[model samples]
Target: MSEHSIEDVTRVVDGVLRSRRSLRAYRPDAVPRAVLEDILDVASSAPSNSNTQPWRVHALAGAPKQALGAALLAAFRENTLPPSPHFPHPLPEEYAQRQRDFGAVYYRTLGIDVADMPARLRQTEKNFGFFGAPVGLIFTIDRRLAPHSWLDLGLLVQNVMIAASARGLGTCPQVSFARFHPVIAQHLAFTEHELTVCGMSLGYPEHDEPVNRMAMPRRGVREFACFDQFE
Candidate 1:
């Protein structure tokens, strides 16, 4: 057995966490099956509520992934699906402002005008293609589960991204897919009990793509957290 120094582990772990971000474009290189399996194996270690481990991931590639993307794009273009709200009806100004900022920065990076709805819709349609990534992952949970249990799935989702990032792969966790959940569910033949939690795109990031180079700003820890007692 071997014991490693805490300092050694901290630097490596922090490096991985800090380097990860949502990759909007990816290279066409194929991610080997074994690598995907290993990433999930590491992610499966995420803590579960009383060990309930309630997450299910449908990893897609090749033909199936294409089929799902096609169906989702069709649903998007036809404008036939019932609305799936990804945000609150009336978002607080604080949060809404942040969302607006992100949109401005995102479109600015792509050189798309914020006022061009048609151009933006075309870009938004890329979510169905997994943003050109080699792998498309759909995570689900039993629809009957309570909201608290859904937290466990969120943990698993974060783990998946971190694990993949550590392996030098890029990922994007997308709520956009939720709007097309019915299309995904039908294409994947999910049981009625399975509820879509989120979708993720995974693969080697295309650094040449302008979107991949966009950097998002984040609030400091002090802004989002508080200390009850000082050391």
Candidate 2:
């Protein structure tokens, strides 16, 4: 057993968390299988309630990934904004406002006019292809699990993103995939009990891409946090 300094661990962990963001564009280079395996292994350490680790990840690459994307994109083109399978609940006003702000900034970075509905549809379509990343990941959970399990899944997702960032990889966790759950379910051959939690794109980032440079503002601690009984 080896002991480590608290200051060093805090600095390292904070660095990884702060540096992680949802990337929009990725380089064509393939992420080695070994590297993907190592990231998942580290992410498996994410804590769960009563040690009930409830997360399933389907990693896709090559032709299979392309096939899945094509299926979903076809469904998207035919359908008019399919309802979200997992997040059916309405968002709070503040939360909804933040989402709108993100959309505004993201589209602006791509030089898309706010009223260009067709261009917006094209941008949304890109999500199904994992934004051109070399690897695509679909996360699922058992239908029998309670809402708390969703929290556990979220922790695991965060772990995966942070771990990937630490290894010079970029990732985008997308809920847009939830819109075409039926298409995904058919492509992946998921059982009746397995529900799509979300999809993630993983690969090295194309830093020069304008969309990749888009950064959204985050509320400071004073805005979102409260301290009680501080000494």
Model 1: worst 10 consecutive residues (lDDT sum): 1-10
lDDT of 2 by residue, 93-149 (tens): 878888889889988899998799999999999999999999999999897999999
RMSD of each: 1.4, 2.0
| Candidate 2 regions with alpha-carbon error over 4 angstroms | 1-5, 80-82, 85-91, 228-231
Per-model TM-score on C-alpha atoms: 0.95, 0.93
lDDT for 123 (candidate 2) = 91
Residue 213 displacement in candidate 2 (angstroms): 1.8
Number of clashes found in candidate 1: 0
- For each candidate, the alpha-carbon lDDT, in order, equals 0.91, 0.90
For model 1, the stretches where C-alpha displacement exceeds 4 angstroms are 1-3, 228-231
For 1-231, candidate 1 gives per-residue lDDT tens digits of 148688888988999998888999999999999999999999999998899999999999988899899889989999988767767779889999999999999999999999999999999999989998999999999989898888999999999999998988999998888888788888889987998878999999987788988778999999888886856
Check candidate 1 and list the clashing pairs: none
Model 2 weakest 10-residue run by lDDT? 80-89
Backbone clashes in each candidate structure, one number apiece?
0, 0
